[model samples]
Target: MAHYKAADSKREQFRRYLEKSGVLDTLTKALLLTSKDVVLVALYEEPEKPNSALDFLKHHLGASAPENPEIEALRLEVAEMKEKYEAVLEENKKLKTKLAQYEPPQEEKRDE
Candidate 1:
């Protein structure tokens, strides 16, 4: 009985030491890393089926989308808008270059 008690006391002391030294915290972190590893392994074992999600999206969108004629009109409008945007960007760049041309040139110093 006394030997058992001594062993129990040593066990408790070791437990306290582990707790005080942050061993338990480290052990918990290790367990969390292990759990993440397991999740990664599962993810790598089987690729995600992205097509299913895309199919779901297509099914939902196909129901609500406008007819082909309307889509064609929108495509033409987008093309026109893109052309206008490019024209504006070209005008902006030309204006910047023109402004730089109007700046006074630095005077060269003559050597004495």
Candidate 2:
């Protein structure tokens, strides 16, 4: 039937679109699959169906995944460094203030 052919044509067009846009390649790479077709089949046959396919892929691909231990450790180290930097800045400010008391105040330049 013409209707069946039209539906098949639409599906084929969609497949081509997916292929041309590199979605197939990206999905395959993210899932670490040797074959891109397997990515499509996996998504289609996922046992615990997710509400959003994009979210499901993102969750699996580390977008919303748990932080890696090394990365978490680096984050904490950065925070500690920032705290140290702030403390040093405050100490520098106090030292400058104390030095200012021991130094002569310069005369302000008056604009004529």
Candidate 3:
């Protein structure tokens, strides 16, 4: 019975130490519910810490989670624009090649 009591006391002491060290603060936990970018930055900047608000935000929000529908729509529009741009670039290359083939080469003059 005494051995069990000693073990329980040790566990309680550890829990108190964690809380006092701000290892489980509310803001840190709330950040977890917000975004992952914050978490990644924290991880890179504070490699030694076991807990980071940034990581909590990232873990809860996920790194790839889009914040708004408008942003997502804009991303899709940008991708479509890039595809169109690539097609135009290909066409331009072909047109330039054809033009070069049709043009006559200039003759170089020799110095007397």
Cα deviation of 50 in candidate 2 (Å)? 2.1
- The sequence of per-residue lDDT tens digits that candidate 1 reaches over residues 1-112 is 9999997896676556545655445445554565444533432343442323323323433434667898899999999999999999999999989987886554522332
Tens digit per residue, CA lDDT, model 2, 1-112: 9999997896686567556655666676665664435545565566654455556455555578788999999999999999999999999999999999986667633432
Mark the regions of model 1 whose C-alpha exceeds 4 Å error after superposition. Answer: 1-67, 104-112
RMSD of 1: 17.4
What would the per-residue lDDT of candidate 3 be over residues 43-80, giving only the tens digit for each residue?
Answer: 43553545544344445556546569899899999999
Question: Over all chains combined, what TM-score does candidate 2 have?
Answer: 0.53
Clashes of each: 0, 0, 6
What residue pairs clash in candidate 3, if any at all?
A: 31-57, 32-56, 32-57, 36-58, 39-54, 39-55
Comparison by TM-score, 1 against 3, better one? 3
**Residue pairs clashing, model 2:** none
By lDDT, the better pick of 1 and 2 is: 2
Candidate 1 weakest ten by summed lDDT: 49-58
TM-score of each: 0.33, 0.53, 0.43
Candidate 3 stretches greater than 4 Å from native: 1-55, 59-66, 108-112
Q: Give the higher-TM-score candidate: 2 or 3.
A: 2
